[model samples]
Target chain A: MSPVPVLPAIPGPPLAVNLRSAQLVYGGLTLFDGLDLDLTGGCFTCLLGSSGIGKSSLLRLLAGLTAIGVSGDLRGDDGLPLTGRVAWMAQQDLLLPWLNVLDNVTLGSRLRGERPDRPRALNLLARVGLADAALARPDTLSGGMRQRAALARTLMEDRPVVLMDEPFSGLDALTRLRLQALAAELLIGRTVLLVTHDPLEALRLGGHILVMSGRPAIVQTLPDLPGAPPRDPGDPAVQAAYRAILRLLEVVT
Target chain B: MSAIRRGLATLAGVLLTWQMIIVIGELPPYILPNPWAVAASLGRNAGSLLSHASVTTLEILTGMVLGTMLGSGTALALGYSRRARRWLLPMLIASQAIPVFAIAPLLVLWLGYGMASKIAMTLLIIYFPVTANFYDGLRHVPPGWLDLARVMLPESRRWAVLRHIALPAALPALASGLRIAAAVAPIGAVLGEWVGSSAGLGYLMLHANSRMQVDLMFAALVTLATLAVGLYFAVDAALKRLLPWHPANPETTETG
Candidate 1:
């Protein structure tokens, strides 16, 4: 028999998520009602808010882990569920205590009943500089190392859209900066949406900042961020952009 | 100053008091044999008793293995499928309320005066805690972690998730169950032997007690206590080795 023809792998459709007339209610109060968000493909958007402005809730909606089921009133455009298209990294780096760094990094794929790919998992671990700690359990790792492992795991799903809810909030300044650079390098062209309280972090990584305030969010999209992200904040254009976002958030001294 | 030194001192004092009691009481030898008498009896009967003890140990080992396999398999079944959890979980709880003491005689009647009866008795007693502990571990994984699995992993990495996440998360609880089961397994075997068996440590104790061999009875009782402690330590050591990341390991205390 002749050699069988090998088919090229199918490419995923571009990420285009829309939240149309979405209403969220907790207890007697309404968090956001009639909220509409239109996100095009390959844009890094940050949702900036105060402590209780539902930034994490929005991320939960995208990830589909929230109490509200997908059958509820909220609908995502492009005929795909919000969760199916997006991968979310929560605030806490919830690595399993028993698994080492490499195993934890590959957990997402493993848990969803996928075949084990050790080399790819190792490569991702190496990317996060956790290749050396691959055999060490999560409890043996430092806080920063755990978070990096979580990041590598998040990247392993190969989802088109990535949603992160305050993934770097608890880290020290120096470590946070280093991770910011790592995230920028990792999330080059993926459709990224993140929730963060830190204006500096948002400005550093996000190409577009969406301020979520009031009952529903009133999004302000800012394009043309200078010198790209992972750039130093001391740059003049970056400083200007920071000031502009700070003014938009209305952080009065 | 040290806790171990204090503990040793306490134990020596207790032994001295026991010796004083034996000297003062002038008790009948058959009723209250002295520690020295019991020791002599143990030395004299060591060969026969050790063989009987070995039989009981084998029964405990067989029961422990079978019971753990059943318990873990049930826990895994209940964990992955909700329908099984709804039915089997309640049935497991109900089984615990029916005392093993009540069922040991029945097991002996059915399986005859043999190792099978002793193993069944141990399995009945040890199965509950293992299943409950492991099931709790499997079901109660953190929501954030499951989300991490869904988002980060592909179709292939799911089994690794169960091993790395489900197994470890449940381990502390499972260790607690196994420790309880280990002690109970020997007791269960002895109870079964007491009901029907002609050999084993339980039978030896019963025979010695009926014949007014007080020293021999004390020897058997001491052997049982030693067996329990040895089994406990063995299980503890195995758990520590299996899970080096577990908080029990002193070498990995830095993270905790």
Candidate 2:
């Protein structure tokens, strides 16, 4: 358990995201229409919604992982296109089974035909408690371990903005709590937008909690809670915010 | 160990049954040679048989390599381009509808009666299976993986996505195609030799049968079977080694 090294901040100021009049339709079904969202830079924003409420779809739109013909007006705070500046983590780990953990973490660099920074990747893996599993294949890992590896890979990208879609939804309670804390520590000062249905998760990790609901999905920001993320999940203030989020979800759905 | 034992036991049982049929039917040596006679013939004509066997093996190997390369190349092209899928896929499928043996004579006419004609025939036999299986594999990459690729890699790096992600993911499927191609590779070479060839096991079989050398013909048949089975196992072993990430079936562990 060596002390974690300080990660250099991503170059340039974090870029805020703004979506205006964005619409997504599939097979004549409107998933969202004229959706507007303002995500402040360097803030951990968690989106809460019920199943099939277009939470993942909105994240995909922000990450630019949407299918062809998806209509949208998405821009950064600098009024420039937001492509190539995002690191996305999906619900599934999506680690290449053919690659070992070390190679998988360095995938971004390898894909760009640049030499993978192996020491940096190994350091990140150590922070995620996967330093010894660097040579192991993804198929050999358990669900929580795989997600941790995915987190290490995501952090290796060093992108200013990170979009995560229910990254910890499948983990057990204890593992989820531990990973949430690790993610918060590693992703500090980066613009992170995490989509999850867990109200408590939003309270524990998000600085700004937004609930997405309705047929044509819209965003409603939850009341800002006291203290930074990795806050006490059992704290009275955090529990109150959790109840408020559950109630808001109840009314919206 | 059990699988090999079982296979050997089955072969012995079949041989016993064949000998029984010969005994019960009271067939003469000229009409149907017994297993003993075939074995004796194999030993007696080992020299000539070995030469012809080597020629057939060369034809099958050459054709297998060429066919796999062409088939997988075509599959990659079809997988990458919608226009190629629309225009060439149908034609590729239609070509398979025509029996490869039916084109043997034409191949011999064009490529001549040497190893070229036999190799061409084997390649034709192999091309369809390799193309169809590899293309299916390439097309059916897990959607989650593709979505990850879309988010991580920019549009300018599409080639990288295909190379690093799609290609490696599709290898197991390609390996399967290669295995099938190897199994059938002998069929094309033998058929081509039958259509028109001065040498090869198929030609030797025809020549021996014409001269009423039934034992020699039986020996040639045995050699061809051994060659086909041997080639199939070689390819399968190579594929297993190449795809270490592909989990081997737990229920059927390899003892050897």
Interface RMSD of each: 3.3, 1.2
Q: Candidate 2: lDDT of A26?
A: 71
lDDT of 1 at A216: 52
Candidate 1, B35: how far from true, in Å? 1.4
Candidate 1 lDDT by residue in tens digits, A62-118: 666655522133334457666555677878888777777777777655565667678
TM-score of predicted structure 2, chain A: 0.95
Clashing residue pairs found in predicted model 2 = none
Residue-by-residue lDDT tens digits, candidate 2, B1-256: 6878989998999899989999999999999999999999999999999999999999999999999999999999899999989998998988899998788889999999999999999999999999999999998999888777776776667789888899999999999899899988899999999999999999999999999999999999999999999889889888988888997797796565
Model 1 chain B scores worst on lDDT over the 10 consecutive residues at B149-158
Model 2 DockQ class: medium
Residue A240 of model 2, lDDT score: 81
- Candidate 2: regions farther than 4 A off: A251-253, B252-256
